[model samples]
Target chain A: DAGVTQSPTHLIKTRGQHVTLRCSPISGHKSVSWYQQVLGQGPQFIFQYYEKEERGRGNFPDRFSARQFPNYSSELNVNALLLGDSALYLCASSAYGGSGNTIYFGEGSWLTVV
Target chain B: QKEVEQDPGPLSVPEGAIVSLNCTYSNSAFQYFMWYRQYSRKGPELLMYTYSSGNKEDGRFTAQVDKSSKYISLFIRDSQPSDSATYLCAQRLVGNEKLTFGTGTRLTIIP
Candidate 1:
């Protein structure tokens, strides 16, 4: 089966612009989470959705938002992007929103804000 | 202090050498420890996972978690050049969905 898949593997955007990255979770998975990884750091969690509801959110600002659809797909939206926002946006999926389930990640969408 | 701390080593060693990577976490509530391997321009792939305390091994990779010391480790034996990548240590609490990650150690296995 295909793992979590993300679109627009790479893109460049100007500061203050908006960007939307998409993700399709594995066929049987019901939870989708978003993470941001900067150049030299490990990924930081952004948001998680399960059954089309927001399950958890990280320390990111209000400018960052995400939603999951009925099919268990997800979209991460960032508004008023800044140079600091440039990073690899990762989408991960798990069997459920609870603990003990192994989370699988996608290749990630690389966003460069200039 | 950060929840998790790692050496962030650009550690290099011979292909046949044994490699050890470690992380220390501040929260005792973290019940699950994991190791992830990430190649450049790619997302992290789960390498190993361990719960509470004890050692779990898969092939050449072994993951150890010591809850008493708040320490976790990943050991790669008879390493190959294909093992060269950034190794990340992550921790999760029993009821939390988010993972706290270390800065990651970059390992290079030279042929």
Candidate 2:
């Protein structure tokens, strides 16, 4: 069974440009979450969706947004990209969202902003 | 202060050695503790997850939680070169919306 799958393993964009990263959750999973991991730092949570509904959001600015599809696929969009936006964008999926959250992560998309 | 604090070590140890990694958190309400291991370019894989204060052993890995001191640890017995990776500690209180992570520690086991 394929765990979580992400597309466009890497990306590059100029300042003020926009980028969209995609993810498909594991079969039968209903929760999807996104995280950003900067160089030399642990990942920071961005957004989480459960059953195609926004369950939680992180401290990221309005430039960052995400939504989950009916099939549990997800897309993370970042606009007005800055050089600091360069990092690994990770997509994670879980059976559900709760106090007992144990997620499975995909090999992240590497984004480099110029 | 960060809710969870971990030594960001590029710790190098020899094969067959026992390795110990630790993290400390300031939140006394955190009930779930976890350790994740990440390879160079891949995502993190959950190594251990324990609730409350106690120890859980799985094969060559052992996870310990000491809620009294707000500390947690992961031990790799008979470490191997394949064990080289970054280890991250995560904690979440019952009401927190997300997991709070500590800066990861890079571990390399040499032959």
lDDT of 2 by residue, A1-114 (tens): 998999899978999999999999999888888999998899999998988888889899999999888899999999999999999999988887465767789999999999
Residue lDDT tens for model 1, A34-95: 99999999999999899999989999999999999999999999999999999999999988
List TM-scores for all candidates, in order: 0.98, 0.96
User: Cα deviation of A68 in candidate 1 (Å)?
Assistant: 0.4
- Model 1: share of native contacts present? 0.71
TM-score attained by chain A of model 2: 0.95
Rate residue A6 of model 2 by lDDT.
Answer: 97
CAPRI grade, predicted model 2 = medium
For this target, which candidate reaches the highest TM-score against the unseen true structure? 1
**Candidate 2 segments whose C-alpha is farther than 4 A from its true place:** A97-101, B95-97
Give all candidates' CA lDDT scores.
0.94, 0.91
Whose DockQ is greatest here? 1
Per-residue alpha-carbon lDDT of candidate 1 for residues B6-101, written as tens digits (9 for 90 to 100): 999899999999999999999988898999999999999999988899999999999999888998999999999999999999988786668888
